[model samples]
Target chain A: DAGVTQSPTHLIKTRGQQVTLRCSPISGHKSVSWYQQVLGQGPQFIFQYYEKEERGRGNFPDRFSARQFPNYSSELNVNALLLGDSALYLCASSSDSSGNTIYFGEGSWLTVV
Target chain B: AQSVTQPDIHITVSEGASLELRCNYSYGATPYLFWYVQSPGQGLQLLLKYFSGDTLVQGIKGFEAEFKRSQSSFNLRKPSVHWSDAAEYFCAVYAPWGGYNKLIFGAGTRLAVHP
Candidate 1:
């Protein structure tokens, strides 16, 4: 089975612009979570969606938002992007709400210039 | 607040040598712990996890971790290192509080395997 998959493997945007990153969870997976990994640092949680509902959110700013589709796919939207937002945006998917063992995608590398 | 700490930012070990990576966590309740490995430009892969069973839990790829409640630590170890083991390892904690599952990740420790 294919693991979690992300789109736009690499993206470049200017400050104040908006960007949307997409993720398709593994077949039969119901939970999807987003994370941001800055250079030299581990991934920091951004948002998590389970059964098309927002389950949890991290310390990210309000400009960052996400939603899950009826099919369990997810999109992370970032508005008013900043230079600091240049990082690897990761999408992880799991089978349940427990969020214990998640499968991650290669991640979308977003660069805010 | 729940947090994870990986003391060593980078570690180098020769192939066939034993390997150990330390992880420490701070949480009020019994936190769900995990260790993930990430290859260059790849996504993170679950190496193993410790929930509520034996202190020593075995995981994929011949990896194991020991959870010590007294020290608030979960350290990953392998009997013999392989060249393929050269990757970034992250320690994470899952706190199930208020019906929300949030993961706290450490800065990660990069393992360098020298042949």
Candidate 2:
């Protein structure tokens, strides 16, 4: 049983560019969430999706969006990235939107210059 | 709103010594608490959780936590620390807001173990 997996482990983008991070959840998982972790800070909630529907969103701006597929995989996209957007984008998977038994992926390190 | 606080930014301890990490939470109802550990450049790993039942819960890697509703705290503890125990410890609480259950994490405490 593999855990949640994320890709583009490290990336660099221009301040005005856009970026997308992907995640694959555990086999039986049905919920997927995204989090952002800045340097020297803990991970903060971003978005959560269950059954291909947006269940909850954090305090992030409209520039950030996410979608979950039928297979419970997810993608987090950030548009017009700014220097402040440079952080570790983490994807977590849980059994459901109830937030029970969630697990996290290694995360994608995004650096905007 | 639900929130967590880790008063200690960093803590250093010697190997074979007991360790305690303080965590305080603010929530309306009985809180669903959890402790997570993250190594450098790694994702968060579940150390333990307190939902209901016994106040003291034992977790993997010899870690344990006790929930005290009176104090609004869920502190992580270990009987003996190891060099590998050096990592960032986070306290979190599950909240039901925006029609979905979410996790709110603390600022995190960095742990350093010395020989």
Candidate 3:
């Protein structure tokens, strides 16, 4: 089975532009989470969606938002991008919202100038 | 607030030598622990996890981690190091937030292997 897959493997945007990253969870998975990994640091949680419902959110700004589709795919949106937002955005999926082991995607690299 | 810590920022080891990477987490009660490996410009791969029972747990790629509750540490170890094992290792704890759980990771320890 394919692991979690993310789209737009890489992209660049202006400081005030907006970007959206997509992720498709593994077959049969129902939980999807987003994380941002800045260079030289560990990943920080952004948002989590389970069963098409918003389950949790991280310390990220209001500009960061996400939603899950009926098929368990998810999209992460960042508005008014900042240079500080240049990092790898990772999408993880699990069996459910009960804290199962999460599988991560290759991540979408976003660079803001 | 919950946090994870990896004291060593970087480590160097010779091929065929033993290796151990330390991890410490700050949390009350026993927390779920995990170790993940990532290659350059790659996503994280789960090495191992510890939930309950047996302090010693084995994972993929000849990796093993022992969970020590007294010290609040989950250290990853490998008896024989391979050059391919050179990568960044992160320690993470499953933490509760809002109404669900999420992973909190450490800064990561980068391993460089000498051939």
Summarize candidate 3's per-residue lDDT along A5-35 as a digit string, tens digits: 9999999999999999999999999999999
Residue-by-residue lDDT tens digits, candidate 1, A20-76: 999999999999999999988999989889999998898889999999999999999
Give the C-alpha interface root-mean-square deviation per candidate. 1.4, 1.0, 0.8
Model 1 lDDT tens row, B1-115: 7889999999999999999999999999788899999898877898988889799999999999999999999999999999999999999998874568867799999999999
Residues B1-115 of candidate 2 have per-residue lDDT tens digits of 8899999999999999999999999998887899999999999898999889999999999999999999999999999999999999999999898788888999999999999
How well does candidate 1 reproduce the true complex, by DockQ?
A: 0.75
CA deviation > 4 Å runs, candidate 3: none
Off by over 4 Å in 2: none
Fnat for each model? 0.80, 0.78, 0.85
> What is the TM-score of each predicted model, taking all chains together?
0.96, 0.98, 0.98
Against the unseen true structure, what C-alpha lDDT does each candidate score?
Answer: 0.93, 0.93, 0.95
Ranking by lDDT: 3, 2, 1
lDDT for residue B17 in candidate 1, whole number 0-100: 99
Candidate 2 docks at the CAPRI level of high
Candidate 3 CAPRI level: high
lDDT of 1 at A8: 88
How much is the TM-score of the A chain of model 2?
A: 0.97
Model 1 Cα interface RMS deviation (Å): 1.4
